[model samples]
Target: MSAPISDISGEHKVYLRFLGKARHFLFNLRSFNLTPAEPIPAAATKAVEVSVALGCAVNGTAQPSDIAAAVKMASQADVALVFVGVDQAIGAEGHDRSHIGLPGVQSDLIKAVLAANPRTVLVISSNAPVAINWEQENVPAIVGGIFAGQEQGHAIADVLFGDYNPAGKITTTWYASVDDLPHFHDYDVRKGRTYMYYQGKPLYPFGHGLSYTTFEYANLEVTASALKPQKAVGIALSITNTGRIAGDEIVQFYVHVNGSKVQRPIKQLVDFARVHLEPGETKTVSFALGHDDQALKYWDEAQQDFVQEPGKIDILVGASSADIRLKGAVNLMV
Candidate 1:
C-alpha cells in the first residue's frame, strides 16, 4: 500500500515522525503497535473457536432485533462471552466520565443476553472501573479485561479457559454503584479514595483476586516485639499451595498503628512479596522493617517539618487487606 500524500516534507517524512513518536512513547509504556505480532503458539488440542456477537453500541439507539439475534446465537452455544465496557470515546485520559455504568445501553444488552443465557461471562475492557453488581450476581464469571492492547482478546480467552491461572489482583476498590464513590472533585485519597481509606463495602476490594489453586498460610513469626529507630525487625510467614494447580501468591504486609495523634490510614501496605508455589509446595516469605519502614512521620502543624511519633503498631500479613490471616504487634521505641 502507498503512504498518505504529503506536501513534499520528504518521501518518508510520516514514517520518520512515527519512529520519533514511538521512541518517546516506548518510555511511557502507554502505546504500542499491535498490527505486527508474532504468531501465537499452538493452543490446547481440544480448543475450539468461539463466536462473539456485538449488537450494542454506546452512541446508537438500542435495537431489539439485534438483541434477539444475539440471544439466538447464545442459546445454541455452550457459554456466552460479552465484551462490554467503556472505551477511549467514553473513558479516556484528561477526561472525566459522566456516569460509571457500562457506558450506555451496554448494560441493557447484558441484561437481555442474560435472560437468554445465564452462563455468560461479562468481560470488562476499560481503563476505569465500572459498576458490575448486576452481572456479578447473575453471571457465572466476570473478567476484568483492562485495556490490554491488540492481544487483549487472546489474553482474555487464555484466562477464561483453564490455560492460565490468573493471580493478578485489583489495584483500586470497585464500588457497587456511582453513589458508593466519593465526590469526583475530591482528590485526597484520605477522603475515601482507595482501599486504604474507603469506609463502605466495595464490590471487590483492592488486592482481591482468585487463583485456580488455593494457598494456606501458617507459622507466622516476628523476630522482635519491640522496634528501635535504627534497628531492624523481621517478619516471616509460611505459605503452601493446597490445591491441584500451581499459581503465584502476592503476600501483602500491612501495619496498623494502635494509637496515634495524627491522622493516618486504616492500614498502610509497607511491603509485599510475590511467591510462586506448585501443588502442595510450601515457601517461607520474610520482610524487614527498619527506620524507613516503621518510622511513621506526619506533617506537624506546630512544627515546620515532618515529625516521627512512637507508638505500638500491629503487623498484619495476608493475601489482601480483607484477607489478613496473621497478626503481630511491636512497640516502637524512639
Candidate 2:
C-alpha cells in the first residue's frame, strides 16, 4: 500500500483562500467546501510530491511535463476511475477551441497510457465533445460529464459507484468528426443555421442521453384542424419507465412546416421538458403549442427580427431529432 498523500497542496491552499474571499463578495455566503482528496496509487502520490498542480494548466503553474507524468502514473495503477479532460481550453465562454481533439500533449498522453493499459475505465470530463482516435472496443465504458456544479467531483464518484443513476441527455449533437459537421462556424448565425438548417448528419443527434432505466411512450393526442396565428393548441402523451432504476426523461417537441411562404428548416425544436419517474411509474406529458413556436421565423432583408408566415404545420414529439415517436398536423391561418 502507498503512503497517504496530503489532501491540499501549498499552491492550492492559496487559490482556495482567494476563492473563499471571492465567494463572500459574490453571494454573501462564506461557507464553502474546498477540501481535497487523498491521492491513491503510489505512482500518483509520487507525482504530486513533485508538483502542486493548479486548477488549470493555462496559468503557467501545471506544465505539459507535469500532466504527462501524472498520466504515466495513472496508467500503471489498478484503479477503476480514469478522469481525463481539458482544464480550461474547452469550457470557457469565449474560449472556443480550434480543434475538437484534446489540447496540448493530453491526447498523446491518453493514447500512450491506453496502449499500455487497455482495461482502464475512461471518464471524459468536458463541457464539449472531444475526439478519441483509439479503438473503443478495448474500452468497456465511456462517460461524458458536462461541467457539473460545485459538487462535480463527489457527484461523479457517486455515479461511478452506482449511488446515482445518470439521467442527463446531450442537448447538442456529438459529431464523429469535425468534418462530419455542417459548417460549424456558421451554424449559430441568424440566417439559416443550427441543426434545423444543417444538411449533414451528426454522430449523436440532439436530445440524446442514456438512462439506466428504460421508458415507453403511448397515447398521443393533438387537437387543432389548423394552427391559427396567435392561437394555442394542446398535445399530450403517456410515458412510463420500464427499468429497475429511477430516472428522468426529457420530452422534445419539434415542428415541420409545410407549404411555407419562405424557406424553413426540416424540423425545428420548439419545446422540451424533463421529468423524474420511478421504476414502473407512468405519467402523462403534455405541451401547449404557441403561435410563435409553430410559425416560421425568417429574417427579412428589408425588415429586422424574425417574421412569422402563414402555412401548414406538423407537430412531432419524440426522443430525439431523428426519432419522432408521435406526429400530428395543423394548418396556420394568416
lDDT, model 1, position 69:
79
**Clash totals for all candidate models:** 0, 2
- lDDT for model 2 comes to 0.65
Over the stretch 232-306, how does candidate 2's per-residue lDDT look in tens digits?
A: 888889899999989888988898878766667878888888888999999999898877763357677778677
lDDT tens digits, residue span 25-100, model 1: 2112343322322344476356455675666765324578777778888888888877777655665656568877
Q: Estimated TM-score per prediction?
A: 0.83, 0.71
* Native-structure RMSD, model 2: 7.2
Clashing residue pairs found in predicted model 2:
226-331, 227-331
Error of 2 at 109 (Å): 4.3
